[model samples]
Target: MERFSNITEALMNEAKIEIESFDIKDGEKIIAYFSEIPSISGFPYKIILVENSDGIVYARFRQWDTEYDFTRWDNGVYNLDRLRIITDEKILSQTESALLKEYLSQLEKIHLPENINKENVIILDSSLWKFGFILKNKNIDYTWKAATEDINVFVPLINLMREKYLDRI
Candidate 1:
């Protein structure tokens, strides 16, 4: 099988961006872990990558967070991502279920050692955290509001596939 991580690292490095990986030894900077999130969870690593003729580039990594998908803002609005869930892990056989549960419980919170966020970024007045990798909670501010309502979305056969995304992380 193709080593999932090697491919991810290659892509990120080629883009002149470093996705977080096991090889980093500098005490696991949060930014390092910031890249290649899904892969870090023993799942696929996906990035919102936009490459163009010019060298400038920007990327966002996906991660699993155990919380709600939407939040309210100081502006009295909500913020969220309308995900089209593609696969469900909950449909696994009974035997598979047992193993998956055990596997998820063993994962670490931070694969690296350094502080996850930069010094200046601070969450606001509310207490709700992000659903996955999203930084700002909409409850504190409407800055991260979803662009559109969900359309043509599919649910995974497994009920906890979404939860697995959080537990695995």
Candidate 2:
């Protein structure tokens, strides 16, 4: 079985882009990051949220095509190629940005326990969800197979983003 960190590293390497690569002004920093590594039957994409010192927020969405060699999967490698930018560093309006920031704040308050057992879930074709957040004194990173209801807390944020930005794509 492949470790979740290894899978995340592979996906990040394949992306050729890192969250730190975004231009951050003196008072601006990345507040949160979310990514979905889809199963063989789903689409692959990532969403990043950044906020300035003034609480202004911006979002960027990147997607990739699955047109790569399937043989590499035997080695636990996912070939996510043909990069697509559904939303590129777009600044959200004040109202939407405030709402997004609120959602991020809510996520910060929720504590997802570590080492969740996956044996209970048996979905064969579920996506893997990853989330990262930078807080005042600590950073949080979590990943879980999308086969359990425990991860549903994130659904609202995902749905909001999808409805606001991804619906067109």
Query: By TM-score, who's the top model here?
Result: 2
Query: Which residue pairs come into collision in candidate 2?
Result: none
Q: Counting only residues 3 or more apart in sequence or on different chains, how many pairs clash (N, Cα, C under 3 Å) in candidate 2?
A: 0
Best by lDDT: 2
Name the regions of candidate 1 deviating beyond 4 angstroms.
1-147, 151-160
Clashes of each: 6, 0
Q: Which residue runs does candidate 2 get wrong by more than 4 Å?
A: 1-26, 40-42, 67-87, 107-112, 115-118
**Against the unseen true structure, what C-alpha lDDT does each candidate score?**
0.26, 0.61
lDDT per residue as tens, model 2, 1-169: 5323336456655543532245557988776777776664345666777777887777877665444433335565454442333446677788877776677687667775554326676767677777766766677777778435655776666665655456633
User: How do the predictions measure up, each by TM-score?
Assistant: 0.18, 0.62
